[model samples]
Target chain A: MQLSDSLNQLIEALRCQPGIGPKSAQRIAFHLLERDRKGGTQLGSALTKAMTAIGHCQTCRTFCEQPQCDICLSTKRQDSGTLCVVESPTDVLAIEQTGQYLGLYFVLMGHLSPIDGIGPKEIGLDVLEQKLSQGGINEVILATNPSVEGETTAYYIAQLCHKNNVGASRIAHGIPVGGELDLVDGRTLMHAFSGRRVVTQE
Target chain B: MQLSDSLNQLIEALRCQPGIGPKSAQRIAFHLLERDRKGGTQLGSALTKAMTAIGHCQTCRTFCEQPQCDICLSTKRQDSGTLCVVESPTDVLAIEQTGQYLGLYFVLMGHLSPIDGIGPKEIGLDVLEQKLSQGGINEVILATNPSVEGETTAYYIAQLCHKNNVGASRIAHGIPVGGELDLVDGRTLMHAFSGRRVVTQE
Candidate 1:
């Protein structure tokens, strides 16, 4: 059927996401048309506002509206000489939901994937090393995902932390094989967090 | 986790759609950030644009950008005799996808569900009767869904059409039980279209 050019354009734009196929895109488009016209407007405004307002935290590289994220700004947090490293800002959110791990975060913003041409520098590993060298960090937890790429990235970071003589640990691999951190259940994620293992220097 | 107020607001607004949970909403929000920052803005803008630009088709009761929808405005469509009656505009799109029907459409926009307090006036049955009495149309294919509510609505409309001496027919029920037309495969929808039965005058 011939939808209006404007409606068609909107659906085409939404189809860029991973799971949203054409049919689902059309359903979403029609649904937006059916209800929440005002909501649709807000979504547009919010997207622009967020893109322009939110920036990566200088310390952790996680998304933040201010120069420092809430976790970084708060003195109430543990900050007990421990830091957890992760791939993306969303990962930080996943970890925070447990209400455990009060230590600081170091967001990599990406993982090491040689095949994809992503190197240590691409993921801000040098920045991480610089932060560790500054001292006061007794423990560094490798909380990257459990994928092959994540494992490789974790190992590289772990080796670097050991060279700097900082205590290094790797988050557990209890997560299912070939699973994304975002897809894991909350309780399972909690278990994985508590079962982290210390990395032996080689 | 402490999401910024704007990000949190965007997530809340997106969660209103069917099948979108909190995590999915966040994923979509993040993906929007990564790609099509502009398109995300457009989606919100379009939501408001469509909501404000469109209203129900005056003739069919289906959503339309103008007073008469594209389907109604098309001179190439077979508008001389037959009319296909449907429950919603989405249903109209479903039927149109088959490339089988060449007749005009009359959208009910709702069904006769007394428990939901929906009645004839609410669904625009009076307008349908008025169109039938105008005496140019010969057949009305009742393309309402096969659910209990859909069946009841079809029967009520069929009765009205028969009393007015207009030829009325109900679309087939070969559609699987508990299945919506939008979800059914196009081929099966084609089968249902071909297998339509004529409504007997009682």
Candidate 2:
């Protein structure tokens, strides 16, 4: 569209983000230019600051501005014999949103997909195994997504944890909440039926 | 969602851009952390560089890293008494995409919406008029969008240009090419039929 060089550059940069296609990037770049000049400056500063300041947390492999993320550093969090393992920080956020899991996390940073060249080493599985072998975690929850890659990754992790003498289990796979059987995809519906838990409530 | 503090901060910063809702911001933040760390770093640098380096071109109000935008500086562009006046730099880009116009630009920076407290002064219309009166630009094309605010701003500028003895005309509003008459909305169809131009052959 022949945008000014600077605006074009900004749009190109923003397009690096997943799901932010060219049109959205252009719209965002122009909108930033039109309004909130100070906010634009702040956005730029934040981007640079975040890139420079944040790094993988040494304990959990989650992005952290500090040496250890707040979640990893907090003593108030249940440091019991339970650890929840997930594929990424986004998964960590999703689990945290439930307000159910009280244990610490061990972010894998990625899933194991042989097709994409992501192996156990690529996803920091060796580190996870080391943590499990240290013998503090009694229950290891494999909370990776229900996708094939995620399942394979979870299974591998669970097998390794079992070999290291740590208890491990995968999160249940089923239809999402608010999903109707008719509306749910065939694969998900099948999974939901197969993994159905017995109702105990009267 | 209990995101890591750094990730949350990054999302908050990204929310400044228009059309970036909380979910999209969160997705972008997480994607930056998950994949393409190098691309993320480049994006960060580009954002900082563009924000710190670019500013409004003094002449045309378009974004520029230098005193004047490249378009304004280019001697090759025909400054042949034609000036395309637009609401913003994005509008300039839209017009440029047509590749039919061979003229300079006068970016209004915003529309004239009194209810919203945006006046002619706010949009730099005074500066535009001043430039017109300097005897270089004979024709000013009002290329604002076909909206109430855009119409109000265009009419206001046209009146100013007429009073100052400069030629001004509104850009055509019609259904897009390749769009079906039946599929087109009522307002657009009406405008298209009304504004239909006479066919000509050499």
Alpha carbon lDDT of each predicted model: 0.80, 0.81
Instruction: Name the DockQ score for candidate 2.
Output: 0.56
Interface RMSD of 2: 2.4
Candidate 2 lDDT, A121-200, residue by residue in tens: 88888888888888778898889888888888888988998799888987877777877768888888788789888999
Question: Could you give the CAPRI-style class of model 2?
Answer: medium
User: What is the C-alpha lDDT profile of model 1 across B158-192, one tens digit per residue?
Assistant: 89889888888986545888999899888778878
TM-score of each: 0.80, 0.89
TM-scores of chain A across candidates: 0.81, 0.89
Task: Show how many residue pairs clash in every candidate, following the order shown.
Answer: 2, 0
Error of 2 at A195 (Å): 3.4
